[model samples]
Target: MSNSARSLPDVAYVAQPGLSGRLDWVGMDDIQAPVMLVGEDDQPMRFPARVGAFVDLARPDQRGIHMSRLYLHVDQALSTQAVKPALLRTLLDGFLASHRDLSSRALLRIRFDYLVRRRALVSDNAGWKSYPVVLTAKLEGGRFDLELGLEVLYSSTCPASAALARQLIQQRFRADFSTQDLLAREQVAEWLGSEQGICATPHSQRSSAEVKVRLREDVESLPFVDLIDCIESALQTPVQTAVKREDEQAFAGLNGGNLMFCEDAARRMQSALDRDARITDFWLRASHFESLHPHNAVAVASKGVPGGYLGGSTV
Candidate 1:
């Protein structure tokens, strides 16, 4: 075929426009891609990510956007450089520049699982834990915004259940020892160690915290590890990756010391996040997937900044 015969037609531009209204966003979703990330250890790694790239259709007369151009820009930028705020800003700029007069706003969302090696509570063992993470960047009206979303799984012990269980244990001890005026320390210890003496146990269930934070404009790198550390520290009962008997005992002690309701969990997270200077605004939901009940208990909190998150239970 001749070179002229092989040329493709640009239907989006050449075809007669039927749509007359502008759109808030136009482009694609679930574009499968690979992104590079630099971990806290300064090692670069590649992870498979689901990406969404879009640009606003500012012109009402225009038929459509150059979807291929957005795809190409996403592909080139994500595959080459590590995912960072600067890279995201530049990519959004490219999205706008490609459509010059046609678009004035751009957005990109990248979702992936970030794995971190975590050590056991009291053992010399470590294993990898995967945390779900989403990075969203938006450029509108010459303003850039970056939001980071993450989920942390931890253990939540019901404070009410713990109190009731302690009451039951005390009753069992009094009944078992009411016959004797004076008891030896060894005998009492043996009875306490038996399952019959400690007749009841508190209920604990796996809980989840979904947090979204709008990062400060001056922050350079993604603070995934730091955020995770801050949250896990606040909760004090993060699910273990590798456990020995000693580690299990230590975890049990932690759960006993940190009994909380869903509201308590939410407030703990809110307080911890409020201390971080890197985050400008944040919204978080603490959900306790209950063991003693069929329904989950949840609490939501926000930074309470004026014109910030509306205290919704969403990420």
Candidate 2:
């Protein structure tokens, strides 16, 4: 080491007058970093993540924290190892250790696009879909907490619209065949195949479900794919990728069968999440971007656990 570099004075050690106050959180946000994550298939993949690292400034007299130490720890821990509960705990421990008495609570948030290959509804072709995901870890008062968040897109067909469309079709059929009695089977079949037979179609819109779950501390793995599967199973109309004619037809069938309002969608999600034992608490919001109206339809739900998410509408 150069003698000149060692002789440089550090200003953080010299507390200026009127600068002694504690901060709730002190660190950096929107830091670009790479992290290795294990997917549902147990494959390790590297993803670019936007990271936020912070520590509470517990010591009132301290001027500031060692921001570089937090950044370096995050970079070293995430870049080298696959992200999980244990690794996150160690990273938070490092933050508190580096700051010593200056901080107590440490929190880390990583946001990334989790890519998964999805198959068409009834075709051999498949394509990749990117889901926006966030993983958060917090350590405070000798306790560790972890939360996972995800967003899934699907199709939502209004049930009232479907019923109304069916009524319209029935009325059209009555008007077309009112004067004819004992119609030929082939003639009726031809009329049913025509566009005039099924004129009115129900309104369906692309919808999104945003969910956040607090996992039990003993949980070993991140359940990103499991949560996605549960949501898709309940909704049964996830937006498709790499569609063929048959696949599109099948998707249409599924949407037609699984007609739901935003409230029904939210209830389905709530019921599914309630059955998962690993999740201690959860909150979800189902949003339907309405095609008939300019406004969107939305429903929100929560696990309603004591000392947990309080059923807030935001997701």
Candidate 3:
């Protein structure tokens, strides 16, 4: 076959004229692309990410966006370099440059599961934990903005339930022991070692906190580990990966010490984010998948800055 005969003509994308209407955003989503990112160890790691690429249709007369160009540029950029605010800005520049007169703003969102090895509490072993993460970048009128979003899972023990359980245990102890028996440590320890000591246990539920932060202009690197560390430290009971007997005991102690409701979790996260200089603004939602109730309990908090995140806004 002749080489010229194999050439396919590009028609719809090249010659077709779309309806004359300005679009707020236009481009592709769920595009699978290989991306390089900084890991917890401050080393470059590669992962497959689901990406959404877009640019605003500022010119109504323009036929359509060059979607293939956007895809190609993003694919190339992500494949070759680690994703950062500066690199994302460059990618947006390429997006606008490809569209020329058709677009004035560009945006990109990438979602992936970030894996971090976590050491077990009071144990020598460690295991991998996966965190859902999303990175968003926007470029408009020569200005760029970046946002980072992630979720951390933890255990939330209801304080009210704990207090109620403690009361029940005290009643049981009084009923089981005479006043003289209560004075003997051996008798008291024997009774406490039995299952009757904890006749009623406080209700604990798995909880998650979804957090989004707007990055400051001077932030050069993605602070994934730092942000996760801050959140985990504030919460004080991140879901464990590996569990030994000692680890489980330590985790139980942590749960007992850090009993909280959804509102408490939200406030803790808000305070932690407020102290972070790299974050200009933050939105946090703490959800408790209640074991005692059929529905989940949720609380939301933000930096409360004007024109920042509003209540109940999706990250």
Q: Who wins the lDDT comparison?
A: 1
Better candidate number, 1 or 3, judged by lDDT: 1
**Residue 111 of model 2: what lDDT?**
97
What is the lDDT, from 0 to 100, of the residue 163 in candidate 2? 98
Candidate numbers, best TM-score first, in rank order: 1, 2, 3
The C-alpha RMSD of each candidate to the native structure, in angstroms, is 1.9, 1.7, 2.7
What are the per-residue Cα lDDT tens digits for candidate 2 across 275-303? 99999999999999999999999999999
Measured against the true structure, the TM-scores of the candidates, in listed sequence, are 0.96, 0.95, 0.93
Candidate 1: residue 67 Cα off by (Å): 0.6
User: For residues 1-315, what per-residue lDDT tens digits would candidate 3 score against the true structure?
Assistant: 477845766563456455777889999999999889887666789888999999998876666777999999988999999998899999999999988878889999999988889999988999999899999999998878899999999999999999999999999998887455436788778888889988999999999999999999778998988899999999999999989999999999999999999999999999999999989889999999999989999999999777778654653
Model 1 accuracy (lDDT, Cα): 0.93
| Residue 292 lDDT in candidate 3 | 98
For model 3, state the Cα shift of residue 6 in Å.
14
Residue 298 of model 3 has an lDDT of 94
lDDT tens digits by residue: candidate 1, 84-125: 899999999999999998999999999999999999999999
